[model samples]
Structures are given as C-alpha cells and as structure tokens.
Target: MTPDLADGGAASAAPSPAAAERAARAPLMSVRNVTKVFGRDVVALRGMSLDVRQGDFISLLGPSGCGKSTALRLIAGLSNPTSGRIEWAGGGRTDADLGVVFQEPTLMPWATVAKNVWLPMRLRGKSFASCRADIEDALETVGLKGFEGAYPRELSGGMKMRVSIARAMVTRPKMILMDEPFAALDEITRFKLNNDLLAMRAKLNCTVIFVTHSVFESVFLSDRIVVMAARPGRVIHELNVDEPYPRAEIFRTSAEYAAQCRAASEALNEAMGGAGAGHE
Candidate 1:
C-alpha cells in the first residue's frame, strides 16, 4: 500500500541515506542502461536506465512513437532489448511474476467476465474451484462484482477495461505494466477509472509502470513521471510528484497540480523538439 501521507499533504520524509542505499541495491526490477534497436536504421531506446522500486507508480509520458510501449514490452519479456540487461530483485532475466495489460481489453467475446478473468490462473493449470474465491475478490476489487456472468459483448468499454484489470490482478502480480489502458474511454469514465485505479493501488501495493500521452493523467496518477524523447527514445526528464496518495478532487484544481502539469508539458514539449515553443 502507498505510504500514508503526512500532515500538510506531502510525501513522507525521504528514507535515511543508508536505507536509500539499501533500496537502491534492491530493485524489484531494474532496466540497466538498456537500448532497443528495431533494425539497422531505427533505434528505439538509447541507453535508458531506470530502477523501479517495489510498489512504485511510475508513468512514462511521451508523444506517440516515443518507445513507451516498447519499454513495457521489454519489461514484460514479450520482446528482448537489443542491448543492456534487465535484472529482477531475485535475479533472473525473463518475466515470471509480472502482469501486463495492453490498450485493448483482448477478452474472448464468448466468455463470461468471470471466466475471462479466470483465464490466467486456468492457463497455469489451476481449476476454477481452486481460484473461485480469488476470482470473486478480484472482480470486487475492480468494481465488477455483480457483473461476473456478463459476456464481453454486453459490457461497455469501461466495463471491459475493468474486467481486464481484474484479470491482471487475479494472479496477485508483483508488478503490472499497463500501456494506456484508459486511453479509449470517455472522459467521465476515464476519470472514474483513474480514481478507482489509485484506490486499488493503495490496497494492493503492486508496482505499476503505466504508459500514457496525457499530461494530466500522468500528473494525477504517477509518483514519478519519466518524459521521453521521440527520435531515439531516451529519458529527458524525471519529475517527482510529492503529492500524497488518495489525492482529492480539490487538489486536482489546486495551483500545485497546475504547476506540476505545466512542468510536465514543458518537458514533453522540449522532448518533442519544441524547446521555448508553445505546447498544445
């Protein structure tokens, strides 16, 4: 769970140097000086280095084609980086405990929501009887408790996404890699899911690496936002969000939030080669 915010709505005090050093040594997952090249001509990631601490909510924000999805794919072990190494805390290369959610729900249309959510566990040779309790709990956690028997064709986009999230959580993953999971939802649904996601994160305490193009979403959801450049995707800036979790709607309208959003926009603009130029 997120550390409780101290009084005055600031992040808790930084850990002691020794503790920080120890944490630096203990990465749930570390992308160490990684690089990915699509072909002889195109470079996707250029020596990107990031340490994802346990339970962190880090967002990679950039323009389209900035390698954000590529980064997630590498971390998911769906694709290998052309160069550099990814080290897990317990020391291994491939992904065994990670959960991934793509932009689309990718649910089997013929299956009930409960059955869809149970697919991951079923693939691991566990029976429905063995995971029935977990399935119910996961559905409830994602706010789809009563819709278990509903089919994908009967659910709206937001509801389908909720099912996708439930499936990702059912396995109790150590980390979740989400690639613009809410990009297709309507504004109201998007905001609702954003709030729900934060609440779920607080309760589950799983590390999240979310990819998004929305500056506001990144500012509202992230503990740290990594802005990346497009042409050979690389981290241009790392912005720390000091706001406490369970942030109120009032905080969204506050000057502090606006300032952070503006900073992120500026960083994005610069990454997109618009330094000193107006941003959209």
Candidate 2:
C-alpha cells in the first residue's frame, strides 16, 4: 500500500524512509543522458536524465521552454531523443503501457464523457460493451460519477479536464504522463483536482510524471521534484517532497508545504539564472 500522509508538518519537509525505500527499488524507466535536437539549430533537452520508480509521483518543475514537456514526450515514446536512450526496467516495452494527458482536454466534442474515457480501451480493441465498467469506474474515480452521459460542451472547463484524466486512467496504465493539465484551471478547481488526483493515483498505484511551472503544485503533488534549466534544458536540482499520500487542504496550508515550495522556488530561480552549461 502507499504510505499514509505525514502526521506532523515537519515530517514532510525532508525525505522520509518510505520515499527512500521507493527510490532504492528498481526504476520503472530511466532517461540516460538524453538529448532532443530539432534539425541543427534547436536543442530542446541536453543530456537530461531521470529515473522514475514504481508508484512515484515525479514533477518535472521548470519555467517555460525548459524541456519539461520534451522529457515527458520522450518517456511516452511520442518523440525520440536525438541522442541517448530511454530504457524500461523490464528491458523493452510498447507505448501501450503509458497514458498521456496533454495540457488541453482534447476530448471528442460529440462523444459522451463515458465514451471519451473508453477511447483508449477501444483503440486497444476492446468494445464499449466490454469496457463499460472500466469507463464508469474511471469517471467515478475523477468525481464524475453522474456525468457519464454529459457531453463535453455541457461540462465546465475543470470537468472537461477531469474527463481527459479519466480517459488516461481508463487503460490502467503502468504510468501516466501529464503535461500541465491543470495549469489552465482556476485555483479552486485546481485544488480540488489536485486532491482528487492523489486519490486516483492511490487506487491505480501507478507512476506519474507531471510537468509544471508552479512550485506549490509540484510540492503538493510530487514525491520528487526535478528542477530544470532552459536553453538546452537539463536538471539543475532534485528535491524530495516526502509528503504522504491523500494530501488534504490542511497539508497545503501547513508550514512544511510552504517550506518545500520555497526551496523549489529557489532552485528554479537558480536554474533560470545560470547559463546552460554542461551537465555533469
């Protein structure tokens, strides 16, 4: 089972035993000295590397054009690194093992929420009749239990994004990649979804790699935060959130959360200021 949330505020300020244990286990995937270059001019990522362990909630935290999304795309096999390799723990695998959610909902406008959630399974050759239960379950998990029949146009912005997340979860993927999915939502909606996402993740026990520019969001949601530099993006710092699962509003308001966010902010600022030097 995933570890429970820390009882004391300070307990979350540093890496916990549970986080260390998880990190020591075999990684689900590793990006080793990866580089993504466009033509001969644009270099998106430079020698970027990270290990995503099972059940980890990792946030690729950085400013715009910091290669956060590029790294995520590489992990999803949506794009290949111009140099270096992305390796799976089990040696080799197919893209089917991943569920990717872009910044936009990108739902089918004409389809019901249920059908939208069912698309992944449907593409995998499962009929709607067969995956009906899974479709409902994914929707319900994202707090859209009674909105299965609602059309995308009928739902609010947050609700539509929830549908997108539900669709990603419908496949029971081993890992999920989210590229700033909540960045466009209002604060209230974002907070609600942040809490909801933790619950959903606990149920699935899947690794999550999220890209974001928000320090608070990254601190609240990630077990590990990898801060990146721009202009040939690379990791400049890595901080362990160490916070427990099922994080509630209280955790968000706690001093521990603030401290972590401050630390993350400082690291990000340092990354932003430094020149894109060689990655050690």
* Structural similarity to truth (TM-score) of each candidate: 0.89, 0.91
lDDT of each: 0.83, 0.85
Candidate 2 lDDT by residue in tens digits, 2-115: 112112223444557766776586679899999999889799999998888888899999888889998998888888899999999887766568898889999999999998
What local lDDT score does residue 175 receive in model 1, on the 0 to 100 scale? 91
The candidate maximizing lDDT is: 2
CA deviation > 4 Å runs, candidate 1: 1-26, 93-96, 275-280
Q: What is the lDDT of residue 31 in candidate 2?
A: 91
Q: lDDT tens string, model 1, 120-223?
A: 89999889989999999999999998998899999999999999999998888889889999998999999999999998888888889999999999989987
